[model samples]
Target: MTSSTQAVELQSFLSQITDRDKGLTAACAAIAEIGAAAAEMAELIALGRLYGSIGAATDHKNTDGDVQKQLDLIADEKFIAALRRAPVAVVVSEELNEPLVLNEGAPIVVAIDPLDGSSNIDANVSIGTIFSILPVLPGAGEPTAHFLQPGRVQLAAGFAVYGPQTSLVLAIAGKTQIFTFDRRVGAFIRTSADVQIKEDATEYAINASNYRHWDPSVKIFIDDCVKGADGPFGRNYNMRWIASLVAEAYRILLRGGLFLYPGDHREGYADGRLRLCYEANPMALVAENAGGAATDGHRRILDILPASIHVRSPLIFGSVWLVDLVSRFYADPHFSPERAPLFAQRGLMRG
Candidate 1:
């Protein structure tokens, strides 16, 4: 198991999963190209201030209403250029208002967040790329409608995180795999296979600064966690907030923890902050493939269909125990916060 022969390179791995289908093969090729491009971006990011103040916000905002960074545009261009060279029909990005038509009649459609957590670039924190690939359904109406399909139908989904080490995490069909860039070989080397989550959650991640804007249920949940060993949960919990989805996801996949971005009563946050397609869907598929679970509080995330390409939704995902507990809170609007101790019996305190 220690030999390099046992380690699969990205090309060989894609070839095995593509199954000789021309369209799928092309789609995997495009994803691999994206990985290569991201690896190059990682190198540039490691150059620090020499990368030309990439952390500076541009004068523009993306479709998600987030301020754009110089690196975001560059990453988008890299992904768009790579995808256009493949047999991709539609390209949807978090930064674009409308889908870009590539090979109009091609069989695959791609949705991407080229430089996720770009805000962390200047801070030298981890950031990465996220993407989802789906087959273009026959007899589509508006081509953009095809991208709104549920996460359950994704053909392949993955992300590449650029941190102290460059890593690519992928989920294809029912399998999840992890690869680390090996500078010696100039290729992504398989590091973990069939990755899965085990529910031993001792940590939770969320932006607690929005406590006043959160719903009662979210407030109660955090309060219970804060109570720690003296609280109803009967165990101390560490709080974490990286503000970067890629970094957060990488940590959760490595060690079990619950991550929440619940919908609050804020002006525009009723539906939560993350996009359904490129952000939540791809991550949901990856979580599900890893033996974890994902939900929008009340329902499994993979089962929810997107109303639009850029629709937002609350995302709560991680080990099954925590995800199911959050869903229970959503299921019972009458549940009182005073009953937090009782809820713990069904959650963290459970055997």
Candidate 2:
């Protein structure tokens, strides 16, 4: 064909693909659709809002609900349904016993904590949804397709925190941004620019009583940070321990901090506490994308994939510099370990 003829054909083809119809071919364009779904879910959750009334009903497993007010099944149903309508292939929710396959052939899979931080719901504290998205294999069908996908393969991950005003934060690839709902305009407006983590921080969060059962690497890092001039970190570090992942993440994002939930030896607590699919995967995405870090106290959290939906893992995620310091403490051998049973016969304090 002549050059002129080729140019004419290209123009015609480009005209055929308008902005409204080109979303699927472009990931950025597709974000609006996802944001819309998230907003709908958030709105539905805002309905019947209450203080101390969230996990009110007895769950089906014949066990006490994880929190006092997890009874808001209606809100969860709406959010799960909203996710189902998207191009998601599988959805693993905190509320479900097993993963729910959305479509057999869709390219996207999402794992969600429908309601995080419900324990503090009565206090009207910040609670929200955490989600991780990964692409599905072309022909894997529904069985075991999700568990095999590594966390590094996530396409998009985010959370919708229902605080005084709902905030939706997203990390697509490595770009982190925040969208806040404008109650007056009734739309989510992009408010925050690129989020950056401070190079160092004074605050760290962890359940420190289990220091005995913690891996030597984590124990060393914590002990060093707290030991000030006598230890490797050489700086006095403060500690905070809020059990809520969303709340902890928000606090870190607002200021600068670190949070660790490492493997412990408590009964039925072998792999630490947080659910990997929903909590670790999504928060890792946010932290890393926002110039921070996320890990299992040994390796990056987003680098590991789950073998099951409810699989739990040790999570130590926060400021990039702080995480790197923790990793260095793990790498070095000179630090004093909080526990030495697995290696050295006795602690230095032992007679």
Candidate 3:
């Protein structure tokens, strides 16, 4: 779709991918509405004229103890209000201490991060929302364990990024797709289909500030990247750290790169920085669907079961080979640091 004219509505596109499951169809409709509302909220945020204050820091913190910006609360309220009209049964939010029970007997449960990258709000950097949809469990009282299911059981996962151009990325039933918001028509339109991450990429994203606090595996990996051509990798690598997961993920999907927020020795950050339910789980699905890999630096991210609603995780994901290398560091203690053959210089045969 062109920037001005409408091509395909998000609902229409979702309908094409989803089949006869009425519950899933209804959930998709709800997600589309949430996306639209979120995009509108983003506009208001960009203009600095929304409920409460746009970028002002609130006295409150979310359930995970992160300080809440004014926009974070507004986005949370707007999303919850929008979902109220949908057929969803249960809702879990990063801002809330507990799950909210909506339409009883409904078939869907949603875990959401209404406003990701709130730290970037004042800087006018890109931020976005993430959601994971799962089937409601039977005979549940509070469904605490239900939300703890491994990411592999997720029915659908996606995120809406508010950057230079607002876009939504989704992975449903193993297929990944991307939709750009056409503000002219006030709808999301298909921009890219079956998006894939390039398997070979040298770029990586991580916070170098935390290098001292990182584990040995994480520390050595970044050391190799910093050394570049003179070090084990034998290839110069680009380093990026936007501190915004959605924006980082978007860039990786387009080109290719590795992103890491592995658990370190720092107190309160031992489990890593990102939340498992809303951040890592959905992201792992999208990365895997795009032919990439995601891990906690020790194991597959989607395989880890959450211990709590706001449990944190060490997320490392991106191009397959880069991710594999990171995982190998944790898998084999004796694995030597060496340059990859792909990046090694070719030379004449030696006697």
Candidate 4:
């Protein structure tokens, strides 16, 4: 753990890691470039409408078929440009339909969501950039082949949240650290060197509007949570839905909670909306490093291999205990104590 008085800069921290592990030299460089881009993005986000309708819709649609926003395009350009200066061989971005090769023989490949939570852009809510870095395979046949490996092999993963304060949450070398952007010094200052998610929490976040579309297991979990102190879990629970993954994740890391975006019956959302490579995988790495857990209801998010660059996956992450409970619901449909008549009036597990 780092003391507040130490005041480590982001670049200094990355440099120290590179010095210790020469193998991570390229990955550390890439992360530094990403932080630089994020700092610039924070400035633009602060400008908001003064930047001339940054939230306005663009005619272009992303690879996922979601309409692109003006800020999305700009963010993509900024990050791609920054990555081009680093030792990056290829970039798989949410905005681009195909993987872009920046350097044929570079040491690393990056998968990124340049602008996450664009839906909240116009509303002036929190949004962020998510990225995962992987080593370029020695004999990889194609550029896309570099990204097919499971999330566990990632060299580094992190996200930059542009909210009340620009914050960077990173997972590298089996550790999770946080940095706050200090505009005065034009750099990120390390705030927390070691972050651990609490094992339990009283809060949960999910889109209640999708309740009708969820599977029985997910419905049962939420139902019990809604019952509060009388529920099978036997504790009062608070609900939250920010419609922004990064914001939700930041909150969970700070305090503790559960955030579920499970696959539902909706046509385009059967596999869940978040992309596997850029969004879910990176977030899963960060969560796990912070002592939390992440899964796709039945399986670990880090274990799932991406069939394609743009494939989607269900995401349920946060407090380890809460995540485990949700997994139990999915693993055994009949395991719902709330559905049993014996526990109708009171919870099976008491506080």
How close is every model to the real structure, measured as TM-score? 0.93, 0.78, 0.92, 0.95
Clashes of each: 0, 8, 0, 0
Instruction: Identify the superior model by TM-score, candidate 2 or candidate 4.
Output: 4
Model 2, residue 267: displacement in angstroms? Answer: 1.9
* Model 2 CA deviation exceeding 4 Å by range: 1-52, 61-72, 228-234, 331-351
lDDT of 4 by residue, 150-243 (tens): 9999999999999999999999999899999999999999888778887557889999999999999999888888998876677888999999
| Number of backbone clashes in candidate 4 | 0
lDDT per residue for candidate 3 within 108-197, as digits (tens), equals: 788999999988887879999999988777776675666888999888898989888889988885767888888788888878777789
Residue 73's lDDT in candidate 2: 56
Best-matching candidate per lDDT: 4
Instruction: State candidate 2's TM-score.
Output: 0.78
- Those runs of model 4 whose alpha carbons end farther than 4 Å from true positions after fitting are 1-5, 337-349
Tens digit per residue, CA lDDT, model 1, 1-351: 112335889888888778765546866877788788878888888887896878888998999888999899888998899888888899999989999998988888999999998878888899999999998878898878889788999988989999999999998868678889988898998898888876878888999999999987888778878997787566789999988998898888888889999999989999999998999999999898988899999888988989999999999999887787677668774454346654545554632
lDDT against true structure, model 1: 0.85
Highest TM-score, which number? 4
Task: Score each candidate by Cα lDDT.
Answer: 0.85, 0.67, 0.82, 0.91
- The better-scoring model by lDDT among 1 and 4 is 4
Error of 2 at 206 (Å): 1.2
